[model samples]
Target: MKRLAVSLTLFLVLSLGVGLLVSGSEVLDWGIAGGLFAIAVLGECFRFWIRRTRSKKRDSSSV
Candidate 1:
């Protein structure tokens, strides 16, 4: 079940990627792609911040 879910998600992403490439000229000048790239970077930064905060709290509580 989990594998099927993962595979479907991968398939969808790949399809979207190929579609984008095929229609590149239509959206090549649009900055939406850049915004998505920024969002991905920010998402990683937020994940790191939350993990660090949780670890710090756990360490302090152990004392």
Candidate 2:
């Protein structure tokens, strides 16, 4: 249940960011929508990677 809530929250935040970018692009350059989405995903992946590594280090240190 806690994991589900976290997943849902991330999904909603990503969707909101992408939706805004796509919608706002209607007035500017629309081609960058895909690029923006890709960049967002890349950033998120990097953040997740950092978090995972930090947690692993912490867990190993405590054991």
Candidate 3:
């Protein structure tokens, strides 16, 4: 969880920095930053879920 939080924070900061550097419009910058943040969060969640499910399958098969 701590690692996830750190990764998410890093993603947000990088996205915001990139957005600001790439776009002149305030709204577009924020939109780009928000979109990237959402993608990072969803990707992390999906990876966690996949790992959890795989572990569960392995544990059950070993029983």
Candidate 4:
């Protein structure tokens, strides 16, 4: 499941990269915006993950 999530993330990033390369005339501009949004979402996900991991660790240590 973790591997699938990682792979899908990579796939989306690569697809956006290819889209930037293959399109012409304002094609890349939109892709850039999309890329930024993707990055922001990923950042939030990572923050949540870190918080969850830390809480889990603390819970286990306290027991």
Model 2 misplaced stretches (Cα beyond 4 Å): 1-30
The candidate, 1 or 4, that scores higher on lDDT is 4
Estimated TM-score for each candidate: 0.55, 0.51, 0.85, 0.52
Candidate 1: worst-modelled 10 consecutive residues by lDDT:
28-37
Residue 41's lDDT within candidate 1 is 53
- How should the candidates be ordered by TM-score, best one leading? 3, 1, 4, 2
Q: Residue 38: error of model 1 in Å?
A: 0.3
What are the per-residue Cα lDDT tens digits for candidate 4 across 1-63? 676477657756775776677566655756664765577567767877998999999889853
Clashing pairs in 4: none
Residue-by-residue lDDT tens digits, candidate 2, 1-63? 565457656765666566666676365443454565556567767777998999999889853
lDDT of 1: 0.60
Model 3: per-residue lDDT, tens digit, 7-62? 99999899988788878756457787889999999999999999999999988985
Q: How do these models rank on lDDT, best leading?
A: 3, 4, 2, 1
The local distance difference test score of each candidate is: 0.60, 0.64, 0.89, 0.69
Minimum summed lDDT over a 10-residue window in model 3 is located at 22-31
Candidate 1 lDDT over residue span 1-63, tens digit each: 565456555655554565577566684423554455455556656766998899999889853
lDDT accuracy of residue 53 in candidate 1: 100
